[model samples]
Target: MSVPILKQGEILIASIQSALSDRELVELRDELADRVGRLRSRGVVIDVTALDVLDSFATRTIRGIAYTAKLRGAKTVVVGIQPEVAFAMVQLGLSLDGIATALDLEEGMLLLQRWPK
Candidate 1:
């Protein structure tokens, strides 16, 4: 299923509330890119707290999304990562290198706001 992306001021928030297939993640990446450009948003927050698992493909897709958003002049913050998911990602060496992360959505938004323009 598609995720809901909402805009709050100059930031776009995408809450991933379910397990998405690789194809769905790709679609999400494209949609976010389009929306960022159209809305002239300066930042994006992706909430993945609901996700119980994050595999290699999903991790890579998220990284790609962050990088793509950066190229479009938007900073990306990934938030709401559960402890178990974080452990699994670390064990698998899926360190989301270079991507900013926050403990929760609130902190994520704050990070985006504090980020230099």
Candidate 2:
């Protein structure tokens, strides 16, 4: 299934509600980039609260999406990461190097709101 991308003010929120295959993840990345450009979004928030597992490919795809959005002049914040997923990502050395993160969607929105345009 395609992930739902919602627009709130100048921010685009993508809530990942299921496990995505590599192909789906790639599609999401492209869709997000296109939307960011077309909508002239100031920020993007990717919510992964429903996901229980995150593989290396998924992690990298998210990072790629963040970078791509940044190139299009939008900041990206990843929120709602489960503890297990966080541990696994760190264990795998798949650090979200340059990406910003928040504890929840509310904080994520706040972060984007305060982010420099």
Candidate 3:
């Protein structure tokens, strides 16, 4: 399913409501990249609370989104990563190194707000 990206002031928020296929995940990465530039956003928050699993591809894609947005002059924070997902990622040797993350959307927004532009 296509994820809905909402623009909130100078930040863009993409809340994933369901599990997405690989292609859809890539589409999200691309779309967020484009929107960051087009909208001149200062930050981005991607909420993946609904996702129960994050395979290598999904993990990589999220990291890519953060990096790409950073290069485009916007900070990115991933939020809503469940406890199970975090454990699974560690077990699978997956990491979101150098990427910012928060426990939920509200915290994600606060992080972005606190960071220097």
List, residue by residue over 33-111, the lDDT tens digit for candidate 1: 9999999999999999999999999999999999999999999999999999999999999988999999999999999
- The sequence of per-residue lDDT tens digits that candidate 2 reaches over residues 33-113 is 999999999999999999998888889899999999999999999999999999998898888888999999999999999
Off by over 4 Å in 3: none
Where does candidate 1 clash, by residue pair?
none
lDDT of each: 0.95, 0.93, 0.96
Residue 63, candidate 3: alpha-carbon lDDT:
95
Residue 30's lDDT within candidate 1 is 95
- Give the residue spans of candidate 1 off by over 4 A: none
TM-score of the candidate numbered 2? Answer: 0.96
lDDT of candidate 2? 0.93
Compute each candidate's TM-score over C-alphas.
0.98, 0.96, 0.98
Q: Candidate 2 vs. truth: CA RMSD?
A: 0.9
Model 3 C-alpha lDDT per residue in residues 1-117, reported as the tens digit of each score? 399999999999999999999999999999999999999999999999999999899999999999999999999999999999999999999999999999999999999999986
Instruction: Look at candidate 3 and give me any clashing residue pairs.
Output: none
Separate clash counts for every candidate: 0, 0, 0
